[model samples]
Target: MRDVNPKEWLALGEDLAPKLKDFDIINPHNFPSYIWAYYVKLRLGERSSAIIWYCHEPLRILYREITDPKGFRFYSKYNNPELKTIDMKAVSQIDHIVCNSRFTANNVEKIFNRAASVCHPGINMVETQDCDRKNFRMVTRIYREKNVERIINAMVLIRETRPDIYENCSFEIVGEGADEGRLKTLVKDIGISNIKFCGFIPDKELPAFYAGAKAIVYIPLDEPFGLVPLEAMFHKTPVIASNQGGIPEKVINGVTGILIDPVVIEVLTDAMQRIYDNPQLANELGTAGRTRVLERFTVDSFINKLEKKFFSLSGVK
Candidate 1:
């Protein structure tokens, strides 16, 4: 696919205007789609309602990377006034706005000075046969923002402080990214041999991994909407995630799973040990997590909200 520039996005919008003229609800999923809706509105006026489904505000990630005190390296690349202007225009022109999580809704309020309805993405539950759920696993791309290294460091702490718990427990990292080599080097440096990097696992095989895992750990920086925790919960696996971002919105502390300050190695280590030493507690958390998913995060519930929103916006009976 060709990389679309802002000028191209505007041109594409003009092209799509006539095609989308008759649609009652022209919902845009991204910036380009926002442009399409904008042009459609310009062409069709009140004949079509333009709603923007923000899968997190388009520039929230860039903003976070720029404002990161540790490093503002990404900021230099995205410091374009024209891009921000277009983004603001797209946000302003939308008839209604919706977001994937409350965290994202708050960002929209801060960035666009607009309130948004939160319609979280759904989790598809999968069936799996019995297997030994005796290991802790994290399913995520190995990226700096993911804080995957924090989990690895916490595991090393577990080995030093609670060798007994460490002896019986295993930690696995699944998925691959640029940080894979660095993470492997860190593990080797720490002399922890039990940690295994499973690389990328296919979606079909993921259910089995989740089914047999003791728990999941996911703690990404300013995560817009974390699906790994919910996916794990759907498989009846407990989760231990960072207290920040959209994680707290789903994984209720002491109920579905444990939430800790991702940077606190001792706290994470304690959580790890708690789950390892008490299988009953783990099972309780896992069962509760599964209940949470069934009630709140299923695909049916998500689609129901979207359908309701579309009907409400279009004045459909």
Candidate 2:
């Protein structure tokens, strides 16, 4: 808004607006925000000082259940309602809505009914995780629904019985959780070092962590939309995600990476073996994923799309 022509400033009313951004929303296939200048226009600010949703997934479902109001790390305090109440309608009423993925867009629309224009999300892709996918690494909040145990069991099975590829590969479980203790027990109960428990790394340094891993893995049995996979893809890393929920929409199976039935360790183990044995296949998939992100998932593109939406609704293009 700082550069908004005086003539345009004369056009908008003073009101708080919503502008969603994400830590890892960028992929050439999905550039959200679309640039950002357009955001200033929507927010009606001296400069765009809108509320940008930090796009929380595992927590979004959990936080809604918190009866007490809480603070948004990026913004400030926000009402704490039942997680189910956070649907699109709740957020849309606030003026604007931005999402990390179209998969998320689909769910947001459920709550708002007529709200939340998705801009995917943006990530600083100047650097990508240097890890190559000769194997697999699982990343997610490890909540109950996230199905962390499944990944561990799958790895154990593969390592014990399927050495063709599993012998050389392992899994990395990133992020901590209530399930952390139990997960450790399961690892010990099964006795597998192939899966490592590297809890949350600081956000800025996460890229380096990812840089060292091969592919990002997520298994949210029924997910709203997971961004970890996309972030992994941002690093030119392939993904092996659950086939449930809206995931198929984000990472195209066989194209971006393999999409398997995370409900069963056998299936997950099978997918891992495939990625391990087929380096050419993994590389091919990861390359396609990178190309997809560059073409559609940039921050600049998101802003543009949103600008068009706002201009159309406000009739102020």
Candidate 3:
């Protein structure tokens, strides 16, 4: 699937458009779907509300590549100026827009000059079994943007500065990506015994990992809207995330979880110790995080808000 080109995906979607009929909504998820939905509405002469999910537009990817060179290196061939123009046109014709986070909403408004309603995607509450929550776990794709190296450096700092807490605590990295080999080599060279790379855990098996974690350290660089933070919250696990991107929207500093600047290793080390030294603080944050997820980030809540937005746009009610 990774071998297939974006144009091929768009072509396949357009080919299948004629078969679909009588839908109340022409909602599109990725870039291919946007092109597909536009053509489908035109072919069927459909009056259905065309609401774009507005997740990953290629222009944004291009911008990210330009702005953050050290962050992620995207192939130059994928940066198509022609597709950007087409994407802007397709977005302009849509009846309404829904963004996953305020970070994404800001981008949509800036590019399209249109306001977007933010409807955060939902995560299910996982039932936790009786297991000892000891180590700090990070469940993210091992990439430069994920800042797995920063977390490891912070652990090294802990071992040097605060050896007491460092001796007792452990760190676990889950999920697989391009940076996995480099990250494993880093832990080995640093001689960090506590940190281990646990390769990709299936979705069904994720509940146990989340439930058993003492705290989830998710400090990704400019994450649009991460589900890991919400999923961790649902499992009643406190998180220590970076104070950037959509993460701030999910975690409240000193309330739900600790937030730190990713560059500051000392601050991150302190946050880890604070949670380790004080179980009361951990419990408070964990309980609050779970409550926040239940009230705001539930699937039912997302669906209800989406229905309202769609109905309002179409004037059905």
Output the number of the TM-score-best candidate.
1
lDDT of 1 at 225: 83
How high is the CA lDDT of each candidate model? 0.79, 0.59, 0.77
How well is each residue in 277-297 modelled by candidate 1, as lDDT tens digits?
888999999999999999999
Candidate 1 TM-score, C-alpha based: 0.92
Candidate 2: segments with Cα more than 4 A from true spot: 1-117, 128-135, 164-166
How good is model 2 by TM-score?
0.67
Best by lDDT: 1
Q: Order the candidate numbers by lDDT, best to worst.
A: 1, 3, 2
- Candidate 3 local Cα displacement, residue 299, angstroms: 1.6
Cα lDDT of candidate 1 equals 0.79
lDDT of 3 at 182: 93
Candidate 3 local lDDT, residue 61: 59
In what order do the candidates fall by TM-score, top score first? 1, 3, 2
lDDT of 3 by residue, 97-154 (tens): 8888887787678777878878778877668674588888999998777888988898
lDDT of 2: 0.59
Worst 10 residues of 3 by lDDT: 66-75
